[model samples]
Target: MTASSLTRPSSKASACGCGMKRRAFLRTTFAALCLPSLARGNGPSPLPSFDRCLEHFMAARNIPGGALAILRHGRLVYARGYGWAQREQQIPVQPTTLFRLASLSKPITALAILRLAQARRLSLDEPAFDRLGLAPLPGKTRDPRLEHITIRHLLQHTGGWDRAVSGDPMFMSHPIARACGVPSPPGPRDIIRYMMGRPLDFDPGTRHAYSNFGYCVLGRIIEAVTGHPYETWVRRDLLTPLGIRSMRLGRSQLRNAHPGEAHYYMADNRTAPSVFEEVPSVVPAPYGSFCLEAMDAHGGWLASVVDLMRLSAALPGHGGSLLTAEMWQELVRPPAPPVARDAHGRLNDMYYGCGWLVRPIQTPPGHNIWHSGSLPGTFTFWVILSNGMAWAVLFNQRREANGLPDTEIDGLLHLAAAHVQEWPESDEFPRYYRPSS
Candidate 1:
């Protein structure tokens, strides 16, 4: 693809964000991705401490751009974009700029399935492969346990295929595509058929192991049940209703990036073999190294940090508009034994819920749920605390200069939240969204 094709959406005031003067916007920088502590009220910055922490962290890592958004009691207390959306083009990362969500997309997929179940369209206990009814690609042995896999198992990452034993089929695009006789990168159905030929890493639901392909299957399940493509059903039924219009499944190549999407940057200038091309060629890991399209159900959505918090705002307790209080309660309940507890039958402090990681907190009297997503050029972390505080952090670069994991941002936010003297009373919801009642 040509460099011209790698460009972002038009920079019109209506198309992009606040057409704030470029020179004026940069004045908010305080080193790193200096996004000045900004709020809608135009009063004092909501969280200068948060700005310092985020900025210092980004500067230390040489990250190009990022965004942070916080919500309290369904109100957007804070939202800001740091550094550049496109460093070379001098496009600043706006609060509305889109970023590839990586594994964070899992939570949204889980939400869709839960919505379907709530509406009595499908049951979580229903057999997944039986529902799809696709034959395994002609292979020597098909795991009988595969038929036993359920929708709940897929949501909880308990489906049989373990990346350690069988290798993550999500990344093996080229070989799977060639084997399946499809395009360069195989789609969800093709990947499922490829897995049918291989033995499962373990029995369905016996253990807890993260599986990207499991959610890939969930996307297919959504299609079979809804009579629509995965993205179409999700956007029309779930996201659009919740005032999340810009969220969409992203592409593996930069040439196909959506309008107003932030340009991705690599850590330490890393490069990898392109997954989109028929013949292997080196490309930036964020763009062509892996197939984002094939990872749609698991980690393929692009969204602004604000849109993500809007999702939080719509959930039960926050706004009591999207999900009922009961669904929210059930969403955090741990999976059946061995997955939720240790060998001795003791409950573990942290466990995987439907999509988010769950940890019970005694002080808050409710559980805190969180999830993080990472790809070649993306690193994102978000947590919904038990005390009704939720924050999302997104970066165009996946790693710091020292090679530390992106999850480090979680700790920084934890400290920043602890230090918050007072959260802004102003809410961005009224200004930013128009959710249907």
Candidate 2:
């Protein structure tokens, strides 16, 4: 794809989310394309109002480091980094800095499923367990209701597992590893077999509950159907075609943090029993409390805010580069029955749809779709709206010093943009971060 073709207003979209080939982008951009404008001497950016808002939010929480990129109608308008990415070594966060994308992985996995469906590789209504054809763990009995769970139920988070009631199995790495008779941090297939033996919290497709294990199974399903590893298929068929080059599954240890990845911090400065060991041992909660490798489909991605914003803008609804218009609408439509109602909302405005949190609006005649990610030391947010505006912000710490929640960024970003007297006519996508082709 040419530089002009990437950022220009064009409606050419692929039936499946495949466009740019990786071979065409054999030459990579020198790490950070926006370093001159974003990271080097952050003095007077074009959007100083946004800079102030982000800086204030970080200062109030004493957040170690963060990076943000904003897009309007598929054009990157602003990109910046703030504070130290590694405070101990004085490494500054850059627009290209990669952070663990907790639940934001859901949207990416969900989009992959939609793309596969668009290609007629799978059906949403197909029984998930039937499709995988994997057996339950040795000697354990299978739940009959497991046969009824469908791909749509998993995508909608209407699958039976409820983290609040039954406790999230994805976090129980040690126990699962023990049960599956495998090494510490068992892979996705072992996790799925272990889950198969347990009874679900509720019947499938009856209600909505966010599930990490559900997406984990989706990962294994992708592997089973495509005859390739989940990461291999996603990069080859989904991400590369979308012009995303740097994203990949993250590892659990600090030493394993991907190159250009930010180090993590905890606000409480607490530790937990390392999931990798049977003996009682404490490690930094962010680095060893859970197994990121096990959370591949739901929350294991490492990426920069710039790459995430590119994904948001390149998605079907925003730039028409992924699924067809009909499947895009199908992607957002809330399922029938009680699943349509919001789980935590006071009104009937927002609900979980496929991979995103959906809020239908009146004036725009479309919906606002977004997803947030949370882990021991990471908090990330991505938003794609109907008005052709999108923003992605990522932090190295999950908590704040002032007792403020991570979700606070949601409102502050909106307010900052609304208060802006003017937005630049420039498109940063091409000038700042477009990879060499």
RMSD (Cα, Å) for all candidates, in order, is: 9.1, 10.3
Residue pairs in collision within model 2: none
lDDT of 1: 0.78
Candidate 1 per-residue lDDT, tens place, 1-437, comes to 00000011112212112243434423332232344543233556668768776776687688889899999988898888889999999888888899988988999999999989888899888999887878878754778888799998998889887788878899998899999888777878888888888888888888888888888999999999999999999998888887788899898787888999999987667888887765449887788888888889888999998999988877775764666676776688888887778779998877787887887777637777878888878888767776777888888987645644355455556556655778788988777788576
Alpha carbon deviation, residue 327, candidate 2 (Å): 1.3
* Highest TM-score model number: 1
lDDT of 2 by residue, 1-437 (tens): 00001111112221111232333211111111112333344466777656766776677678889988998877888888889899999999988888998999988899888888889999989999887878899899999999899999999889899988988888888888999988887878888898899989998988878888899988888887899999999988877876788999999988778888999998888799898765347898898889898898999999998888878777765775778887788787877677765566334556777888777767747877888888888988888877888888899987645545566566556655655678888877765344535
TM-score of 1: 0.88
Instruction: Write down the worst ten-residue block by lDDT for model 2.
Output: 1-10
Off by over 4 Å in 2: 1-43, 278-280, 342-347, 400-402, 432-437
